[model samples]
Target: MPRVIGIDIPDKKRLEIALTYIYGIGRSVSNDIIARLKLNPGMRAHELTQDDIAKINTLLQNEYVVEGDLRRQVQNNIKRLVSIHAYRGSRHRAGLPVRGQRTRTNSRTRKGKRRTIANKKK
Candidate 1:
């Protein structure tokens, strides 16, 4: 495993694919990074030289928000929404679907497991 920006990327995977193991980077971003660094997209991660890794680290730190920073930024955004009492924040607070999905039937993913109620005796 090669460590990129404190995240360990699989050495067996292609450079482009391995880059996606980092938190904020997806396929397109990985491609962009590879292009900017003039690295071969098809090259395995383990093939990277120390200089290449240094270049990647410099580019990421200079231009991109990733890993811990990205996570913290996202959490801050959610916290802001909750502080403002937004509807989405309320849904998040309640652990329900944030989007306007019909909760009457579906949305078990957000709503979690069902708790059945017992019948009242006479």
Candidate 2:
């Protein structure tokens, strides 16, 4: 494993793919970082030199919100929405789909297991 910004990226993967292991970095961001830093995307993470790792660390720290910082920022956004009583926030608070998915029948994943209601016989 190679450590990048305190996160251990898999050593066997290509540098571009391995970079995605870091929080807030995805395939596109990884490609963009490699392109911007002029690093070889095909190189394995384990093959990175000390200087290359240093450059990546520096670049991420200076230009990106990642890892704990990114997590905190997202949490803060959710909290802000909830505090403001937004519709999305209410959905989140109710543990339901936040993106307007119909919950009448197909939202079992979000609404959890069905509870049977017993009917009284006349």
Candidate 3:
């Protein structure tokens, strides 16, 4: 495992993919970072060296908000929506999908397990 941006990336994953394990970084951002740092995207996570980590950190600081800062910014955006009573906010508050996905039968993953009524005995 190699630690970068406070994340421990698995050695088997490609460097670009492993980079996505950090919050606020996705495939696109990982590609951008690798390009900026002149890193080989095909490299394995375990092959990353100290200077690579430093280069990544520098690139992120210059061009992106990441990890804790990004999380807080997203949380604040949701909080603001809730404060203003938006429909999306209400949906979020109710723990339902905010974008109107059908929930009648498919939201169990988010809504958790359903309870059942007991059968009567003779």
Candidate 4:
């Protein structure tokens, strides 16, 4: 494993793919970083030299909001929505889907286990 910004990326993978192991960095962003840093995307993560790792670490710290910072920022955004009583916030608070998915039947994954209602016979 090769450590990048405190995340241990799989050494067997290509550098571009391995970079995506870090939170907030996806395929496109990893490719962009590799391109900008003039790194070989085909190179394995374990093959990187100390200086190369240092450069990557510096670049990520300076130019990106990642890991804990990104997580906190997302949480803050949700909190803001909740404070303002937004519709989406209410759905989040209720543990329902926030993307207008109908809850009549298909939302069990989000709404949790079913509660049966018994009917009285006449």
Candidate 5:
């Protein structure tokens, strides 16, 4: 495993794919990073030289919000929305889907396990 920005990336995977293990970096962004740094995307993560690692770290720190910072930024945005009492924010606060997803049947992921209501005997 190779450590990048404090995250351990799988050494057996190609550099391009391995880079995506880091938060906020997907395939496209990983490819772009490889291209900008002139790195061999086909090379395994373990093959990265110290200079390459340094360049990657510098580029990520200067040009991108990632990892802990990205997570914190997202949380802050949600908090702001909640403070303003936005509709979407209310959904988030309620632990429901926020993207207009139907909750009638398909939102078990957000709604959790079903709670049964017992019948009352007269």
Candidate 6:
């Protein structure tokens, strides 16, 4: 695994995909980073050279947050949402679908095992 901006990116994944593991770096940001650093999008993480690491590190530190800072930012956002009592926040509170997906027919994973209705007695 190659370490980028103090975070280890998995060896086998593409640069964009691997960067997503570090938090805050998604597809668009990864593309921008690669473009700015002149890095190959298809390059495997572990194949990166020392110079590549330096360039990527510089880019991340200069313009983007990763790892611990990114995590804290996300937590703070969630906390703020919860404090505001938004629908998504309520979904987070209830651990159910936030997007108004049909809870009656779907959301088995969130809703857990369904109750079985007993057959009517003859």
Measured over all alpha carbons after superposition, the RMSD of each candidate to the real structure, in angstroms, is: 3.3, 3.8, 3.9, 3.9, 3.1, 4.7
- The 0-to-1 C-alpha lDDT of every candidate, in the order given, reads 0.91, 0.92, 0.85, 0.92, 0.93, 0.83
lDDT of 6 at 108: 91
Error of 5 at 62 (Å): 0.5
Q: For model 3, what is the alpha-carbon lDDT of residue 30?
A: 93
- Collision count for each candidate, in order: 0, 0, 0, 0, 0, 0
What TM-score does candidate 5 get on C-alpha atoms? 0.93
Question: Candidate 6 — which residues are off by over 4 angstroms?
Answer: 113-122
lDDT of predicted model 4? 0.92
What's the TM-score of every candidate structure?
Answer: 0.91, 0.88, 0.87, 0.88, 0.93, 0.74
Clashing residue pairs found in predicted model 3: none
| Candidate 1 lDDT, 1-122, residue by residue in tens | 77888888999999999999999999999999999989999999999998999899999998999999999999999999999999999989988888888899989998777776663333
Taking the tens digit of each residue's C-alpha lDDT, what string does model 6 give over 1-122?
A: 89887777898998878888777878999888888888899988888899988888887888877778878998898788889998788787787987888887989989777776674334
* TM-score of candidate 3 to 2 decimals: 0.87
> Which candidate ranks first by TM-score, i.e. highest?
5
RMSD of 5: 3.1
Alpha-carbon lDDT of model 2: 0.92
What are the per-residue Cα lDDT tens digits for candidate 2 across 1-122?
Answer: 77889999999999999999999999999999999989999999999999999999999999999999999999999999899999999998888999999998799888887776663323
lDDT of 5: 0.93
* Location of the lowest summed lDDT over 10 successive residues in candidate 5: 113-122
> C-alpha displacement of 91 in model 5, angstroms?
0.3
Of the pair 2 and 6, which is ahead by TM-score? Answer: 2
| Consecutive 10-residue window with the lowest summed lDDT within model 6 | 113-122
